[model samples]
Target: MAAGARVMFAPCISEGLLLRVQSLLYVGVSVESIMQRHNESVEKQGGPSNCNDLLTHSYVRRQERVIRRSIYELDADVAVSINMWVENHQSHVFFDEDFSDVDPLTLGIQTEWQLQQMIRFGNHSLIASDSRFRTTKLKYPVHSLLVINEDNKVIPVAWIVAPKFESSNAHKWMRAFYNRDQTKDPAWNLAGFIVDDPLADVLTISDVFQCSVMISFWRVHHAWHKNLVKKCVDNEMRATTSRRLHQAVDNICQQRGSKRLFEDFIEDFFDESDFVDYFKATWYPRIVFVVSDSQWGNRLYQEFHKPRAGVTMRKSKKKEEPVLEDLPKEYYDDVSAFIL
Candidate 1:
């Protein structure tokens, strides 16, 4: 019997093949592709006429189990090392609870330098927080707390890895940074909190810290544009509608316009379209917070909407030729000598 058929007929997969499959999987190669490669290799070696039957889904599942077991074994050691490191750096790292106690782990890390910078630059400033996914194979959402420095550069103050991006998880993440004891600290001063999701992130920030909440303009603009594209008839109509809507949004976001102006613009430009109705129902109420002079509106405009200084290139003035009358007598003598 051929080696391929012998291996398949055996009760367990061969050690060499298992190792090869593990290596391929470790480097992100899919199981289907690996099976195809194995079948092609068997055919090239003339090992089996039914090369496709040599590799089966059962083999892939078995290899996956072995890989998982190996990873679990390694993770035990890694967990110990991580514990030791965290104990050594307790001031810079934080865990919501023991890993054994939580289904999905929640951990936050901030360096000493980052903490100092946050205190120095983040206090009474616009602090923004958001969540990002697909950053790792673990598939956990990474929550980040950031602030703008004196140079207007965005600096991350803290990061929390959590199971989900819900309001409760966000509250837990923020609580890791500022508990009830630290809330009274003067350095906890925050002008406003900017977030992508008003429901998930804003609920926690506003309730816990009692700070002004500002919705990200990019998210708002994206929603407006996406809905306009879906509701408009054609490219021409979409472009014209988008231009007028964008102007209104810009003015509102920049704190230069009011709800009355926006309503008037919508009424004058649009004639009872689905887009208009959606905008009124969904986003109209939020305009108060976006353009209110007393609260988040002014703070948001000050931090993000204000124009920044930029370097401008000026045209160089042409150098004027020196007049012969203004020239020294030696210059005229030299010119006359050269002519001769």
Candidate 2:
């Protein structure tokens, strides 16, 4: 366009050379394709062009090699850079740089740090955390620990970008600040765990580390799954109800020679008069859904919160053990709530 035309008219640049450079500079147009097009255009005129000398694949690779760094090297470089940044900024900022506790498992590769400044800024009193695995060109699975600050912003604390997602890696990430000595580790203490099912390995965590942090299943995901199940069940019930209604009408017609009579009877049965409050009744479930929400919740609750294989000790006496306490509300809530 206008810019290209101006460049083509430059004092030292020829129109032919400008056109060749423009063709090579297109996004996603490979050097090989550019070379082929140049060769065809040159052949139509006379012979091969000199543009291939500059736009060769080897030359492109050489240029890339000058700038590119391996992901492993980049990982180490970034860690060192962060360490330097913290050292420089710690005097001015209210941040903690106590990542000296090397995880014997990770060998201090993934150390945890906290920005205490956000406590003065963020919304929630709680520390929000989530993990991301496999985030490198090498496909090396690096589990990163991120927490929300006072501004409700995510701050990366540690990166266990090890190739595996083992229990030891997770334990190492948590164990970095597992110091009982109050003098060295006064601020770094885990109050509780708010994690999904995968990270809810609370029982197994006891073997490696000995600290009681209450683990709660992520509520949003649990509610979403329940909603999905409810939708699926509702769709199935609607399909089955329609099929059954059609079959019932056909049977009535064969017996009484009138589909209208069956339709009238069905309409009257479904009609919620002052005497028949449809919302409060459970009898309609059999004619529609397989089970009511309460019935389904009760069934699921019993199955999920089934008693573990041991009795509790009460005053040196054995007692029946109970399931998980303060179960999530989604289990027992009405199906109408999960309609969305």
Report the lDDT tens digits of candidate 1 across residue range 1-340.
5997666644344544554465555435688888787767777878665343355667786777766654343335645645665676577575454454445567676765556556765565556565542446654467677665554545566767676555345676676676522543554655556565443445577776666665555456667778987887678877877777666655654557667777786787576478888888887776544454355443443222323321111223463221112212211111110000
Q: What is the C-alpha lDDT of each candidate?
A: 0.56, 0.34
Give the least accurate 10-residue stretch of model 2, judged by summed lDDT: 331-340
**lDDT winner:** 1
Q: Model 1 compared with the native: what TM-score?
A: 0.47
Off by over 4 Å in 1: 1-91, 98-105, 133-138, 163-166, 180-187, 201-203, 223-233, 247-340
- At residue 21, give the lDDT of candidate 2: 39
With a 3 Å backbone cut-off (N, CA, C), the pairs that clash in candidate 1 are none
State the local distance difference test value for candidate 1.
Answer: 0.56
Q: Candidate 2: deviation at residue 146, Å? A: 3.0
Task: Look at candidate 2 and give me any clashing residue pairs.
Answer: 121-150, 122-150, 122-151, 142-161
Error of 1 at 317 (Å): 43
Which candidate ranks first by TM-score, i.e. highest?
1
| TM-score, per-candidate, Cα-based | 0.47, 0.30
lDDT, candidate 2, 1-340, per-residue tens = 9998545433343444433333233112455665576456556655433222223445444434432432114335545744554454343222233332353223223121232322221112222223333244334344434444433333443344443434445555445423321224453433222232233344444443343322222232343344434443455544444344445423422333233443443465353232123212422322223122233322221112222211111222353221122222332121111110
